[model samples]
Target chain A: MPEKPDRNAIEVRGVRKVFGTGENAVAALATVSVSIRENEFFTLLGPSGCGKTTLLRLIAGFDYPSAGEILLYGDDIAPQPPFRRPVNTVFQSYALFPHMTVAENIGFGLEMLNKPKAEVKARVAEMLRLVRMEQLANRRTSQISGGQQQRVALARALAPQPKVLLLDEPLSALDYKLRKDMQIELKRLQGETGITFIFVTHDQEEALTMSDRIAVMSAGRILQVGAPRDIYDRPADRFVADFIGESNFLKGDVTGTDGGRATVKLSSGTEIRASLPEGFSPSGSVTVVVRPEHAQLAAADGGAALQGTVENVVYLGTDTHFHLRLDDGVPFIVRRQNARGGADSFAAGSRAGVVIGGDAAQVLRD
Target chain B: MASAEEIARAADRKDIRDRWLLSAPALIIILVAATGPLLIVLVYSFLTSAAYGGVEWKFSPEAWVSVFLERDIFDDTLSLADANITIFWRSIKLALMTTVVTLALGFPTAYFMATRSEKTRDLWLFLITIPFWTNLLIRTFAVLQIIRNEGIINTLLMKAGIISAPIQILFTDTAILIGMAYVYLPLMVLPIYASMEKLDFRLVEAGYDLYASRWQVLRRIILPLVKPGVIAGSILVFIPAIGAYVTPSILGGGKNMMISNFIELQFGQAHNWPLGSALAITVMVIVMIALLVYVRNTGAASGERRG
Candidate 1:
């Protein structure tokens, strides 16, 4: 109860959504509840059909839950129309009005609010500057590039200065370079506007880079909600572990526990120590998940190491990825930063040691 | 041998020649079948008429003058009073009425059709065209059977006790208008439906998201985007409805005469071929002028979308 101490910018409590009816009913979301704090850059990260978009739509007033309350800044706005809501969405398609000029599209929300012409003009000019689209203000939306159109959409949504901004995969259409550029721009925009941004994206890296806190959703349920570091380092379950980043899972039996750390003995009798996650059981089979980046390949060691022959060495601009396997044929990967340590590179068929620190590997419940 | 640049220019000229060659057949057909008759009619309008419903092979300005003047063949003085102008005005009014009524009725139906699922829209479109499969005269008579007193509609309404008297809906201007609309309803619907089909519903959603009221969004966004369809539908309905002959002849009881009906009288019972030609030429000129203006406006609107 004390965890969410501050006032919530948007609270979606006990929301359920079922599409269609009768025999064809689909449960898009079930018992979804999350409180987003003001000025927090929160992202709902999930694969397609995970109901992340459903939850965002419910908050934006584009959709209503079949059963539950949606409170925007402590006021229930469930029955209100989208136009009546104090939130704006940057749509996935960057839904710019093609008939209108960029400035007109940006100033549309202000015009709808009955703002004076001079004030609307000033705000629109400021927004154009904010999005670095001041020179393209007079051009029609159809005349702008995809990235420029994206900025116009962002500027248009932000021009209204809503309590919360909902972005529905706003960067999925952009290429890699542009998407990366906009991620930083979006973070800066959120910071400057000081508005709660509930962004939805399937891209894990995009979610990690822009969000202060992220809620990992799957099958219409929130699997975990925490800061980007927390979600990446200590994922709640196997699904979260496999989804966030690349990891090598080793099936092992717990041999012993040393306070916070537990030593697990592998099938090949190789003993490794790893930090136990919460509620970790002792003296049973467990799965030890270690990221490729966390495990390092060194000279064959005598203790606390899984010895394998280097089967492949791949140079990826920033790091070297070495594929190896234990004597029992258990495959392992080690991603070593190219700039770190000695100039020695492991060749295929060379004996190597896979060293994962106790805290580097994560153990999950089942 | 041609140089590289000269060869490129030659290839471009060959490309242009091939394009023109591909269109030549249709162009030839249009000129021969469509404009050929109109050109003959245009020539006939300036010629003199003989004593017994034939041409005299002489040039005269009498057919053009007769539209607004009444004069004896031997008389030098011309009276500005004429019934032809009245008939022309009445035909214009009736055609305008048909267009306005069909537009009002067809717009909503086309919008509904456009909003339907693809299969449902196809089914409705097929049904709309089914009426066109029948002969135009037969379709007009079919409407006659439905709306006439003591007909199916009258019997049904009387049987339902909604009407004690047989409704006098037959052989009136209302009947002609109804027949025209029923015949031309598909024309108005098809182009509008085509336009609406291509519309992005996301634009409407974006409008609503920007705090625009439904009506404001429709007026500001939906209407403008679909303007091309409305213009196309209007042209499709207007040009043909203005020159319609049979709908008025069959349903008008010869009382509500359109310009086509008047032109028919000139060529048939009235025996004034030059006058008919002149009136036909005049109507064609008017329709062309209207179409040119509409095309100009639509071209300007389409420019905004492109730029």
Candidate 2:
């Protein structure tokens, strides 16, 4: 079979999932539409109760959307049961069958599909090798370590050769070290299997490191869908900026506009240039988002630079954090690298100037 | 002043002694009150039966011999005791059937209860155990009232014109089976429910995600995971059912006698106390063997799953 690089492997069209009924109804996904390309590593990034897992469940056919369609390679699978779908999930808990051996767990999908015995054996052996768990094939899942159990779960889900593999926080249960290792391992497996991997996680770092593109969701709605660099460098709004990374929100008024760039007047009467959101024309007050690392401390020249008093100085090995109160009494944080001979040791209660880097400030539309 | 280590050791010894003293009463009661009658019955099995309804203090294996073999009254030849064999077969068969029927009924009911929300689960469990509040004999009689010729089932059928006359459901093996199953259903349900309630339902979701149908998920995952509870429930129901006295006597009408009823007859009408004791020992042996076989089978099954 030839792989179509440009075609969509799965498309969720205007999907809305409302749980419960009447007064108790809660919308977990509200009119969401996104397309996952073939063999692409897609991620749904959100915090708890943000409906990222709900979207993944809809794609895997474990859940049905209240109001829209889910298409797997052009065929609508919205009403189909999970068993009937050609997709599989790597659950957060691993969910390995405790009674079966690792090999049997890996072979379960094939066996359920009624594949031939020899075929199942061969596929299971291949999967065990792929997951680097050949030595633990005969071991009961209960006897395996958590990380090893995670590998077995991955092997089991991949053994079915699903069209799209939906991973629901598969590494959330692992320790920090193991989570890092599994993240790399998951990316490698996705590349090798050439399957469209739709991963869900709340860890922005994990999403940024592993996903080819991420859809940042908040409160049952997709805030922005873009590459990690695109999302980090140019967030669509204050919520996306705040959710993906630490950002300082400064209350500002739009003083002037120039195409995609706008001049915002800060409370301290300092006018700074910020990039505007697409097609948003702001005339009143706005929120300017600036990442901690985007601003640097300099001599308080008292001109064209936002000045603030250093409230706290925290040394954190590789970087030092300067928590300062801006002239308007708004708390702002600036992170400076602990480079040798390049450190600006500012004492607490000392006045400092924060020079916002060019094109780093993002003017929010709302 | 005594050394600290020596004082700690002495305190440990005293603690051990105190613990033993505290538990001694329960231990003594279990040994004497529980196993005391069983020991007497074991001893009586090897002694001779009195002319009336008691044992004679003389060593004899006649009771053990008569358990499986009896001398022909007219021919002076020993042969298999057909009546004893029949009663043993009936007892084993009914118990096995009752176990199977109760498991078939209890498994889904337990699963249903286990799947319910926390507040409602207690309600379901309470409902399952409601039958236990009544006396066992009364419960059996309640079943008799339902299945008897002039009882509710027959009257309903006659009224509905489904039958011209009442069905002779009572005084039959079916009646005893129904009664035993109803009586022991809670025993089967509770243990299985305990295991099922602890089950992680995510495993079922994983099974479905692996393309397993509903039936396949139940057969391959759910059933195997809950096997220990099934085995426990089966043993709980089967052991008492094999030796049940009341349900058989009431619903089977004394004609279809179980092993317990036969053993009772040996002491009452037959005046064979030694035979009754021997029969009781035999039932216990059968139960032990059944338990061993059950354990072995499940152990092998689990090994297969691992493999």
Candidate 3:
């Protein structure tokens, strides 16, 4: 279908992939569908074997969905092979050609496209510059370090100006400092090129740092999709809240709702007010999800709170974590800002009262 | 009591002595078996061949000259009608052909083996090596039965109405080449398979991701990467095939002589010790040169790999 390049870059519709047959069957992805906007830095973030990489491979045409279609610019490209697709992948291993020089590796895609030699040279040079690897253009891949090889892999993929660039945990191989630097570089690259990037990663922080939007996946399904702040602020379920960051869940039943807030009655006869997520009914079973940083150890005089013994004290550099257990056998953790003497004020086995603010806790459907 | 430093030094010395002792047996065997015979060949190549089979122990260039030039007893002139050079060139030609055939047959099999599932790959590798367990001569003899007149292949073809008579395959250069290639097939396949098995197919995926067609990927990426293994396997086949004595004599029916058969003739039938020694020394020199070239190429390839 004829369409503008600025249209939706990718639309994976009801895609499913099963790896084997009979007793050994593995459903790598199941009826997963998402729309990735053109020029958006989209990430599929999940733990390993969560089907994020499977979806990326499907988009890049390295793999085909067992059912359903993947459309590129409104064209169903599910039947197409990888080389025929408009998408390129920076593989997780950086899979740079060992025998070729960095320049040759970068030019390979352009040459495969049958571009004129001069234009190929110009584009390769531009890619090398974009990756900040001009100095390493002549070096063979084996002569370079892992970080340099990573840049070469990027340049090689970007040389042909593919409409959609797929990256599979490209920073997983880097050290902490290099990963930090690359996260920034990747955002800049995505911005400058305005190419749709479907990046697959298992790192929540990396997804938050680089992506315009992220789809959190688990057990071969997309749990939620939103901007980083939206995901961190309002997780859709217990899994999303727990997977994204540290969160404490208190199993409760919603007792009442007023205006936009919900009052959930905990099993221990304590009640906490939380904003009810849409589709959650009053008087139904719900889980109140509170980020550890949102709950704090309060003074004994604070009203309407759960009092528990501090089971463990962890003095993190910027924050101290209190692992608390209520007398009813419910365990939860509280993270507070370690300002001056604020930390080390609570000793293990000491009694502490934790207050869960209505604005800080979220009511999840499940 | 000795100081700690002195104690450590003594321990280090003992360790060094132990290391030497561990390798001493193999080293002594190599010296006696390899270097000792090589020395005899070097000396005997320079000395005169007696009227009999033994060396005369006198300085002479006759044996060396016989490899390239022949004395004209009637006209006192040197001509290049030497049978030794012909046999030498014939051996090189046969070895080259054998190497080419083995590579053509081996590379695809190795690639096929590499692509199989791990358990299937083991089975195929074992099958490729099965021929090696049998003696080379016995295996060649089996091939003779298959290709010879009134042999199994001919009987099958005749029974199937495909041929009225057996084709003239035995006792030909083609047969010799077939025998050589068959003998060296495993040598070629094993190394090429090793390299193919070690290949990072992720690079092949990367190639396709970068818009390379399957042909382009195979030619530009797979071919260049697997060349090192092919070269290694080629050397393993070529060097041994160049000095091949049994295959040609059996397959060539004692008439189609190679340099090795000529060397044998000089030592046995012709009873010329010095000429035989010279030919043996020359063959060794050629094999050594081939080895140096292979090592140089492999060294450069590995250096590039380190990049």
Best by lDDT: 2
DockQ of 2: 0.76
Model 1, docking class: medium
Clashing pairs in 3: A141-B307, A142-B307, A143-B307
RMSD of 3: 4.2
Flag regions of model 3 displaced more than 4 Å.
A1-6, A255-263, A268-283, A295-317, A320-328, A338-358, B1-28, B46-52, B55-59, B159-162, B290-307
Model 2: how far residue A171 lies from native, Å: 1.8
C-alpha DockQ of every model: 0.50, 0.76, 0.48
Q: Give the 10-residue window scoring lowest on summed lDDT in candidate 1 chain B.
A: B81-90
Q: How much does candidate 1 score in TM-score?
A: 0.91
- Candidate 3 residue lDDT tens string, A100-181: 8899999999999999999999998899899999998888888898888888888888888899999999999999999998
- Which candidate, 1 or 2, has the higher DockQ? 2
Q: What is the lDDT of candidate 3?
A: 0.88
Of the candidates shown, which would achieve the greatest TM-score relative to the real structure?
Answer: 2
Across residues B1-307, which tens digit of lDDT does each residue of candidate 2 receive?
Answer: 9999999999999999999999999999999998999999999999999998899999999999999999888987999999999999999999999999999999999999999999999999999989989999899888998999899999999999999988898989999999999999999999999999989999999999999999999999999888889989999999999999999999999999999999999999999999999999999999999999989988997777555
Q: Residue B151 deviation, candidate 3, in Å?
A: 3.0
Q: Distance (Å) between predicted and true CA of A14, model 1?
A: 3.0
Put the candidates in lDDT order, highest first. Answer: 2, 3, 1
